[model samples]
Target: MKIIVLTSWLILSVSIAFSNAYMPLKDTELESIASQFPPLEYLNPLDDGGLLQPFLIVRIPGTENSTKVQNHVNDFFIKQISQGQNSSSSEIPMWKVTHDSFQDSTPIGDNITFTNICVSRDPELAINEGDKARTRKRLTLAAHYDSKLYPEGFIGAIDSAVPCAILMYVAKVIDKALTRKQAFLNENGVGNENNQLGLQILFLDGEEAFHEWTSTDSIYGARHLAARMENEDIENVDGLIGSGLSSIDTFVLLDLLGAANPRIPSYFSETHDLYNSMRSIQKRGRNIKGLFQHKRRESNFFSSPSVSENVHFLGGTLGDDHTPFWQRGVPVLHLIPNKFPPQWHHLTDDVDHLDLRTVHDWAIIIAAFTAEYLELTNFILDQ
Candidate 1:
């Protein structure tokens, strides 16, 4: 009994000592990052007959385009991985990067490929190159890469392309924060507990059903991946450092973003704090110029809102990508527009339906909340 108590106390002390380790990224840096975007190069793609088409149709699992997009995102993650591994501590690319891949035949009748791109310092962490140290406390940013079906080609710019791109951009902005944290730990000779801060950006395949939205059709990738995690005994619910428990502290799913009118509500009671954090970040972003010009809605059940004509609050989950993880008891924060645009799941859900400013605000707010949750701020409490 005494030994257990002593161990617990020691762990607490170490945690507090490293509590101040995380560093907050500045809004100015975020603005600079946002400014570099309009990176349309990633958007336009070859349709057919040697012509480029804006529409991205249902990239079904195991198909050429599906693999191409997966490899693209995986390669995007690897660029930073190479930078970090090749460079010294001073040059530890803005973000520590690595990834994991899951492939299997799903209940939906097709073999699927799911790739989870990570920005982290977990020592079993493998870049596209190889593995590193084991992972620790994690915060994940998730979105599906596959666009839904439409009569005409479907780009799904708002359906999810913007959200996926936003995660990539957020990962880019977060690189600085991760490196800054690493730099501090190195200079102070603080044990690399900050390595526990994990950032996972998942570009899930097969989010759109091959036929229709059904238990057997939709989320082919997520269902397989979640089951596999459980099978491997990787998920840890009450541990500070382990495989899956440390692999993901919270899973945040972003979908249907970058539309003109946006309304995100606190979907799950358990994830309310994280949801509120996004809201807090939203309010904070008001000072950041060129961010969130459109009026946004918030759902605070506890307090009465200012009865303006504009009101935003969601009562329950939207049954998007977070469904599988949420059911498995993984903490989930769903960031989806409550009032989905009329173009949702339609051929018209293309760039013409997207707002760059909305994209910027979504990226920044999510980045801010993620920074806060990871304790990446220099402001350590008086523990």
Candidate 2:
């Protein structure tokens, strides 16, 4: 009897330990709080029903501005793709764009330029909202915006465009919900409110630098952005560093997210932080009596590479845009689907081949994580 009792106690202790290691999703009550976006159902052949439309640009000037830029970039893609446009490419290009504004002398000096490129709904959404004014924690969502260079008739849909759209949608949902939550609290005479977090959506250029994957071919923009963010010391605000505990907060990179019944790889230790954040959102959604709740299972759908944890490219590696950020030690949660999508790099990656449900789920997960992180940090909520 004593042995059985001790064994039961040990099991209970183990369960609790594991539970403490991670947060749980809310009470299985995910409700839809988003507006019915028409683009979600669009099917025009002109631009793959709008998937090829380019939209959004987010700048993380310093660590303080990272999160907002990340979220903004995330939301921008979500809205663009949800409204019917096929996501063409999702990359955060960090480059130097220099133009000589003269006819006499060579352009003054070479300027390092970082322009995020992703096909979107329209240019209007790309515009930056006026400065929020406070020192903020920053995070980046990097993806390529250009579709594969398949035959001219091919849409190259799965190559990357779909993932970009999903990121944009998630950002919008989180931002919109926060805005509404504050309003609701105000309406109910609640005394206090939290500030909003920022997210930058970096749509990269030259990801498929060459036709195939070579050391020098892919990750053109990512390399530039990573170098710049690490090398530059633009601000004097000491408070911003403290916001992230004097470390880079997070850089969630999205890739092959449009495949049907996708499976995310449980490949990195850093991903647990992100998973915990998502669970927090699920909980908050339930606690606040909101629409968001247990819509996803937190466990990763796939396993990490069998060969080497440090080596990103291995026997069964799926090389997407997550490499550069990981190289910089910025904790990247790369969201790649089960396997490379079949329509990838092909002409058939059109509206018909895409899966709307997968896109929707992908957007939700991103939103959940953002909301949870903002809440847990108490940075946005401390307002």
Candidate 3:
């Protein structure tokens, strides 16, 4: 009799504890997430010089009618963020150097036929700034913008297109916050002393592939960049954090976020701090809404508590863009949406598969972290 009573009481306690811990996302929050990426007045149909025109179907968010509007906006941001290709920049060196063009170098001694090869500079130049109290503390949000190699049908919207767009929102917000914080500090007489904290919004160029997946095929761009940063001469770099919205920081890549709210695997337990950060942001978003009840609220998709203890093994192939950084001892937090999008790797992966609320929620989380890392508070008060 006593055993039976104890068991019942134990079950009741467990149930009550779980009930108190769980919190469902509300409608207002969803609306807030949708608003993060406002719809575009116009969209192109191809990825051109920084302007992306998504496939009409891929642009729509959700599998239902209710999310159409938000999906359109999300699609716009994703499309627009891929405006620039691998262009030459002094800030970040492009290692491609051609000694003799195909027209210049050549077929040995016989005819002197020109030959060209893409050569990478001996991974120098970009180095990590020594770990500083403020500098060593960084949260890097990385995403690859390139689509996978498939027929015209594959736009890779779910694979990584959405993640890239979301990263940009984070980049912009953090950039703004950091700049403001810097200004604040200066105005208030504080200088670079506390200006070391930073957030690197890394938009990798090639995460997809041309041929087989090898060190040279996928993640070439990010790998090359990270290698350079590890060169020991770089300055002002610290810790690293990678983020995606589809899945929590379990490092599980999101292949299909455009589907309905899919089930996320039990992967968050593998990466504790990152999981904590995700939950923290979700909590913050909820708290903000609760506090400003009369005002507006924001939607956050990553609000649930993760209960899995699954530790994801680094799948041999550095699946996404974050793989390279993770390889170099940099901590990575990958955020892939649940399940594979129906249009994944197809022309169908166009705008229709996008969700504005998803993008918006992602943007909020990114913004929060960027603000935290960059420590932009100095700008406000100093300025």
Ranking by lDDT: 1, 2, 3
lDDT of 1 by residue, 257-348 (tens): 77765776565555665565566566655666755444434422112224211234332224567666766667677777556777777777
Evaluate candidate 2 by giving its C-alpha RMSD to the native, one decimal. Answer: 14.0
All candidates' lDDT scores?
A: 0.55, 0.42, 0.38
Which portions of model 3 show Cα errors greater than 4 Å? 1-138, 191-194, 212-215, 235-271, 287-300, 303-306, 309-318, 377-383
> Is 1 or 3 the stronger prediction by TM-score?
1
Choose the strongest candidate by TM-score: 1
- What TM-score does prediction 2 earn? 0.57
The root-mean-square deviation over C-alpha atoms between each candidate and the true structure, in angstroms, is: 10.1, 14.0, 14.5
lDDT of 2 by residue, 1-383 (tens): 00011221111111001111222323331334332322353212234334333321222111223233334444434443234322233221111112111111112222322244432211111112332232233445666654433355544455566666665555444443344343444345442112322345666654553344554545556665565556654321222322121123456677766557565544455465554455344345434443422244442333333422343422114445555555545555666654666776556666677666555545555655555444422212213
Candidate 3: 10-residue stretch with minimal lDDT:
11-20
- lDDT winner, 2 or 3: 2
